[model samples]
Structure formats: structure tokens, C-alpha cells
Target chain A: MAPKTAPSSGTSNSFQSLLKSYIETTSSRLKLIDVFLLFLMLSGIIQFAYCILVTNFPFNAFLAGFGSCVGQFVLTASLRSQVNPANRAEFKDVSPERAFADFALGSIVLHFFVYNFLG
Target chain B: MNLVLRLSSALLAAAVVHAASLSIQNPQFKITAPDASQLRSESLSLAEKPEALSLGPSDVLKLTFQVVESEERKGVQPHQTFLRFYDEATGEEGVQPVRVTPGGKAKFELNMARPPTSLPPTTSDPLKVSLILGSSTHSPVQYELFDLYVPASQPPPAHPDEVAFAPRPEITHTFRPEQRIPAKAVSAFFALFVFWPWIVLLGFWFEIGPRVPHLFSPHILPFTASLAAFEILLFWYWVDLHLGQILLYGGILAVPTALAGKQALAKTSEWRLGRK
Candidate 1:
């Protein structure tokens, strides 16, 4: 508004480069985590929409579906934090193997309760 | 269980009526069908029982009846005619009255708004409806039997017969929601079985996922105790929802959402339950 400047090509290219490099540097484990998280999130959102549309006729079924999403979110978020290089300093004392084990155990325990609630 | 009893009783009543038919005939049906069957030489039967009829949702039957005036019986007591869906000993059902016009002709309609639920295809259970002509409570001037059948293809029957019954033994005042649910203690006990995994998860989640007490640790006692206490709270909550709290199924829906709150707290620690 001040000067009507139209010279932004250089900054836009730099932004694109920044995004590409960040994506390129991210580990496959973290990418896998992203994919899984996205899956859970999208599925959860779809199920929520269906719940709204059907008005939760089968409450157990609705709960189970929603629980899967949230339960997966808990497990996957932990996995993401552990694998993320930027967050490496926080969990430095915890090895990746140990972190994976925790995620696995947590997932099993969550699903166990989730299945019971579903019934 | 009541349905079984009603059916059995109806069958027994039908058997009794069939046994009585060989020797005795009620006078009420004397004019219904003048020559119901071509067996007048064998027996003076005025009306024959309707054949086993198979009825569906859309079927409507037009049945004819006549009230004959004979010189042999100069003045007989006029009887009121009604189509009873089933014999009284069998169960309580609808009684459709047949209107006799001044011309001495009467018509009865056997109609179904929806297919019967009780009648099975191979069922020999007589539809055993009674067409009774009577003015007194226990005495009938005449009576007739009509039978029908139902198939499973039809939607569950409308107005399945119901029998009036009394409790075997009286009990004390019944109050509270749990009374409505049978075996309250057993259901509550099994709920504890479900609590083990759920409580562990809650404990883990309550600790914010970073730290977790071992499943058998005393540290998780408070979590389990709180959850167990809340189990009763959950039942009462459902009772409230079902007890005219919401419109239609809204109560049923609130149950899972309310229960999900536990999981939500476990997964996100939105409300803390203090981790060990």
C-alpha cells in the first residue's frame, strides 16, 4: 500500500526452495509418520461427518471408529516427535528403538481399550 | 415367552373345540352358512370352519353371513355377533363386530395392515378366531372358528397377541434406573472386567503418554478406583438420557459420547486424572 512494489519473484523462489529442502531433508521414518497421521486424520474426519449425518444410530460403532482415529493420533504423534530431527535434542537420551517400542506398546494398549468400548 | 404361552393355549383351546365339534354344535352359527358343506346327511352342520388361510399385508377378505329366521324356532333370543381374533384363553385380541343389516345379511372383513409376526409358514397353530353370538358373559348362543396362516416374508405382525398376566410373587418398591435393567449386579461385575484395559489406558494417558505405571502397579490404583466409581455414574447418566431426557434416540447417542470422554481424557489429558 505504501509503494505499490511489484518486485517479489526473488522472495517467492526462496520460499519455494525452503519448502523443497525441508521436505527433502526429512527422514523416511518421519514421512511415514506423516502418511499414517494423515490417514488417521482423514479417516477420523470422514467418520465424524458420517456420525453427524447418521446422528449416531449405533453409538458403539461411532465410538469405535472415532477412537481408532484418536488412538492412532496418540501413537503416531509420539512416533513423529521421536523421529523428527528438529526434536532430536528433546529425546536425546531415548533411543529410536526404545521410542518405537513405546509407540507399539501404547498402540496395543489403546486399541485394547478402544475395542472394548466399541462393544 | 408370553408369546409362546399364548400360542400354546390357543392350540389347546383349538384342540378342545375340535373335540367338541364331533358331538355338539353351538346354535350361533346355525344361520351363518345354511349349507356350509355337502355333509348335511352325515351331520347337521350349518357353518364350516374357514379353511387354513394364508394372509399377507395387502390382503382383504370379504366374508358373507346370514341371520336366518325360521318358523321352527318361533322366537329365539337375538345374539350379537363378533369376530374375535383369537380365543380368550389363548390371549387378548381385537374383537371386530359384524353389522347385520335390516335385510338379515352381515359381512365381516379380515384385513391386515401389516403381515403377522407370529405366524410361521409351516405353523399349524390355528388362527382360531371365534365368531361368537352371545348376550351373556360366559354363555354363547353360537360360536364358529376361522383359521389363517402367515409367512415370514411378511413384515413382523402388527398387534401380536398379548395376554394379561400377574406377577408370581409381589416385590418391594422398585425405584431407580438399575431396577429396569435385569441382573444389575452381574452387569456391573462384568463392567469391572472391561475396566482393566480401560483403566490402564486412562492411567497411561493421565500421565500424558510420557510416563506410565506398570499395569499391576499400586500407582494405578487411583485411576482404576475412579473409573470403577464412574462406571455407576455412567449407568445413571444413561438412565437419565433414556428417561425422557432427549428426543427419541438422542439419549442412546449421548451414552457413547459421554463414555468417550474417558478415552478423550486418556488420549489428550484434557482433564487430568493425575498420573503415577
Candidate 2:
């Protein structure tokens, strides 16, 4: 029984190793996404700092600053989803053109509301 | 046209009602002479020279006597004595002694005697007058010197009523320093919830499923929706606290921050995804 358990444990370790190798070899957009996420995160942090330091006096400026970044982030994510090969299953019928249109429409609406609120 | 006419008529009616309710009235007053007959009183006015009547050794005393006879006593009674002071410079007369008796009898004495030579007459000085009667040498009566010029006769000055400029009532109000802490804390919390959490979730979503290219990933929408709800709540709370200005300024900050986030995300995404 002990000898049999040893083989199973060894097999489990080999399986984990194989999985790790496969993940390492696979095309990982994680780095790019991380960098993008980091940029956005840093921007949000800086704006938060501005809000704290500047005392939120010019509210429209702050809103415009922050809202545009969020809108861009959403637009970019949508673009990535529409254009990425991995997302073909979900957006198979949705062309990149349509995706771009959606992005544009979403951005327009976001900016419209942002402008109204910024003032 | 109908709506405009209705609105105009409503406004006109309001104006008419307002105008009809307004009224003006002038205040009224009554004037009557004092009942001196029963009181047996007499009154006199005096003029003084040199503007102010002053007493000195050389100043002459002028006396004007008005004695109201009692109702029982007819005419021609004992002599009524009065004292008066005369300003030698302006030739103005002053009532020195005014006497009113219980029977409403009054007398005035003008000092005509030259002031003592020892004391020189002073300019614009007040002259003291005393009326003596009934052999009461110890108790001489005195009266206030009447200003020959009345205040009303003069032209109104620039500040006729100087009392208006007097100090106003002091106001006092108190506020606790800690009262602002809650508002600031709430503002910060909402800011984080509305804007920061999305950035974090973006990072998390990428880490969990690196190959998944869905923008409307199930996770992202909920987080974004939560942020929206939080933002609305904060905005409502801000309005309730009368911190609308603060909220407005916060929104302004949020805009550029959002833009910068988008730029960073796009640049990073393109760099990683190998996209132009």
C-alpha cells in the first residue's frame, strides 16, 4: 500500500511540473495586462493624491481627469475583447468594426455625461 | 399661444393682487397748550448777547417778570421780583430765575446789576441766575441757561442722526473641529470605492485568466456596477451634507485620473499584446 501511494504522489508532482511548463510556454498576455493595469492603478492613485492635496476645489477638473481615464480603460478592454483571438468564441459574430463602433458609442456617452458632470 | 397667454394672465393676476394689497398711511399727532390757568403758571423767553450769556462783575442783570395771578386774587398784588443776566457783548438776555408756586404763580428775575468789577466778563460763558422771595435768603433758586438758537432752525448736516453709526450687536456661533472629520472620511471612502477598486479588479482579472480576452468579464461588470452605486450614494450623501461643491471638485479630479488610467492601460495593453 505504501509503495503504491509513493507512485501516486510522484505522478502528482510530475503532473504539476508539466502544467507549470505548459503555462510558462503558453502565450501569456498577463505581463501586458499587468503593465496596463499598473498604469491605470497608478493614475487613479495620483488623482486620489491630487484630490487630497488640492482640496478638491476645482471639481470639474478632477472629474474630467479621473473619468476620462476610466472611460479609456473600459474602451481599451472592450477593444481587447473584440480583437483578441481567444475571445472568438464569445464575439465570433461581432466584427472588429462593430466592436470599434461600440467602443466609440460608449466613449461618446461616457464623455457626454462626464462633460455635464464636470461643469 | 394659449400656454403663453395663460402664463401671462397668471403673472398679471399675481401682480394685481400684490398691488391691491399694498396701502399707505400717515402718522398723526396732537398739540395743545398747557392748562396754566388752574396751575397759576407763567412762562418767559430770554435772549442773550455774545451768543452765550455770561456772568461777570461788569455784566448787567436784566429781569423779565411774568406773574400769573391766582383765580381768587383779582388784580394788583404785591410786587413780583425776578432776576436776569445780560451779556454786555451781544446784548442778549437770559432768564436767571424761574419760579413756579403751588398756586400756579410764576416769576422771572433778570440780573440788571453790573457784575462785580473784580471778575472780568468771559466770552460764551454761562450766567447763573437766582430768584429770591419771601425773605428766604438761604434758599435761592436757579434755572438752566436757554440756548438762544434752536437745533431745528439750522440746516441739516450731512449726518443728522449720528446715532445710526453706533456699534452693532455682536454675534456668536460655535462649531466642533471633529465635525469635519466624518465628512472627509466619507469623501475618501467613496472616492476609493468608485474609482480605485476598478483598477485593482482589472489587475486581478488579468492575473486569474490571462488568456481570456473578454472585456465584459463577469467579474468586471459587477465591480463597475458596485462602483457606480457607491458613487451615487456618495453623491446623494454629499448633497445632503451641503458639500455639493466638494463633490463637484472631486468629480473634476476623477476625470483626468480616469483619462490617465485609460492612456496607461492602452499603452500597456498594446505593448504586451504586440499591437500597433
Candidate 3:
């Protein structure tokens, strides 16, 4: 078990290579979604930190600020997976047009709620 | 004649149900102590029908609510808690918002501008106070999802002219809860934050949920950590709602978070800008 680096490191390196390939091959749209998701998640963190420091004096405001980002991330992820022609095979019954429409509808509804709750 | 009677009865039943659901109890009202330093009466008191309240311009009014016990009311996260003061006689109204925090009670202090002279002497209606609950007014939409298992005895609602609909109210505002915030708005936030990815998992179960391991994902883990940290900080604030101490403590947390945020952004920029 000791001398040969056959078991643990071999699989780990292969996994890394696979992930790198996956990320590299990912479309610009999907990558852009990933970046946007990253932005939203980080914004949520910033709000969270601000909340911890300043206090959530305006609870509705805090919820709206944070909730919008989280909600968008979900919507965007749905858009990404559905818009990808690759996942089309998996979701055979669903059309990408329908998926995009759902995404749009969800965003409008989520933002409407967020805007209302915003202090 | 039998069909008309059945339709009328159905309409009446629906109206009754709607009315029962919408009714609200009259609020318990009192005036706060004129002195700035005093606390309100420790034992909760509800004022009876006073012909008139002897209130000066400087006097403050107090409104109190018992925390509701029902699950529906339990987590009523207040959106904006405010007092709507209306003097019927003077026909002047004022709004003062008092934000509700996480306490087992609801209390508000409202300063009067001047005694509302417009109110009728015989009428006991003081300035009206409205407690606006959650800002979002989303009632669950009902869809006929294969309306299964209907009894054959059940009759359909009548055609348009068969049932007489009442004239709509001039102002169509839902009854806003006085104390607790409605759970409708914020609970969605909670669900979205905590369990939404699993919802995605539900659809694409083959490649998601356990397979991809979203829990440990970098994008997700940070927000979860943030929520936990924020919640702990909130708990501290709740124990003693001291703004000064909270700001001080918040400053202490912000420094490290600011640094982490900068670093995270740096890496994220690299990813976004095609560095990786």
C-alpha cells in the first residue's frame, strides 16, 4: 500500500483532469452563468456580512437583498441546465424555448417579491 | 326554481366562508406615559369604551398585541409595521411606522400632533392604527390538477347571471396582521436559500443531489457559512437590542469578511476574465 502511488493519487489526478476538461469545454453561456452565479453568491455574502456588522435593522430589506441573489442563482442554473442542448436529451419532454420562458417568468416573479419586500 | 335556490345557497356559503376568514378583532389601545423615562404598564391593560381620550398634542399612544399562537401567525415576519392615525372629525390622518423585531409581543408608540377635534363626541373611535404585515400579497393560486375524486352529487356553479355579485369595495386591501410579520414572503427566502438546489436535484436526480454533491460545492458552502454567521450575530442582537454594541461587534466581523471578500473577488474575477 505504501510504495506504489497507484490507488489514491491516480484517481485524484484523473478527477482533476476530468473537471478541468469539463470546465474548459463548457460553453461561454454556461461559463457566464457560472460567473454570474458566483457574483450573486458573493453579493449575498457581502450582504450577510453587512447584516452581521450593521444589524438587520430593516429585516425586509436584508431578505430582499439576499433573497434576490439566491433566487436568481437558482433561476440561472435552471436556465443553464435547460438551455444546454446536452441536458435536452435528459429532459426530452421539455423544450429549451419552454425552459427559457419559465426562466423569464420565474425571474419576474422573484424580483417582484423582492422589490415589494425591499424596505 | 330548485336550480336557482341551489345556486343562491352555494353563493351564500362561499360569501360566509370568505367573510369568516377575513374578519379581524378590534385592537387593544391605550396611551403611553407622557413622561419620557417611564415604561408602559407591566400588566397588559385593554381600555374600555371611553367617551373620549384626554390626550394632549405631546401625548403618545400605545398599541399592544399578544403574540399569536397559531403556526400561521407564529412566523408572521412583519414587512413594515406602522400606525395609521385617522381622526374622523378632523378628517386628518397620520402614519408612523414601528418595525417589529423578534419578540413574543407587538408594541408601538405614536406621538399625536394635536387632539383630533374632528371626531364626533358620541363616537368612541380613536385614531385608527393599521399594522401592515408582509408587503407581498401572494395568495396561493389554485389550479385544477385533474380535479380527481369529485362526488357525483356535487353541482356546478351557475352561469354568469344566475348569481348576483356584490359591488366591489372602493379600497381592496387585505387584512394586514397587527403584530407578527406574515410568513409568506420571508419563508420563501428561507426555502430558496436552504433547499432550492435540492429542487433542481428533484428534476435531474440522476446526475444531481448525491452524485454531484452540491452541499460541499464552493458556490454553495460560502453562502451557508454566511447564513450561519449572520444568524448567530442576529441571536446576539436579539438578546439585547443594543445598536451601539451591535455596530461595534459588526465592525469586528466586517474587517475579516472584507478581506475574504476581496480575495474571493480576486479569484472570481480571474475565473470570469478567462484567466482559468
Tell me, by DockQ, which candidate is best: 2
What lDDT does the true structure give each of the candidates? 0.51, 0.47, 0.53
Which candidate model has the greater lDDT, 2 or 3? 3
Each prediction's RMSD over C-alphas, in Å, is 24.5, 24.1, 38.6
* Candidate 2 lDDT tens digits, A76-104: 68776776666779997875545654664
Across A5-80, the per-residue lDDT of candidate 1 in tens digits comes to: 4347667778989869866886554655665676677667766765664346557867986897888898889878
- Give the 10-residue window scoring lowest on summed lDDT in candidate 1 chain B: B32-41
**Cα-based TM-score, every candidate:** 0.29, 0.27, 0.28
Model 1 residue B173 lDDT? 88
Whole-model lDDT, model 1: 0.51
Task: Provide fnat values for all models in the order shown.
Answer: 0.00, 0.04, 0.00
Clashes of each: 3, 55, 7
Question: Which pairs of residues clash in candidate 1, taking residues 3 or more apart in a chain or in different chains?
Answer: B28-B142, B116-B157, B117-B157
List each candidate's DockQ score. 0.03, 0.05, 0.01
lDDT of 1 at B132: 62
Interface RMSD, per-candidate values to 1 decimal: 14.7, 12.2, 14.4
> What DockQ does candidate 2 score?
0.05
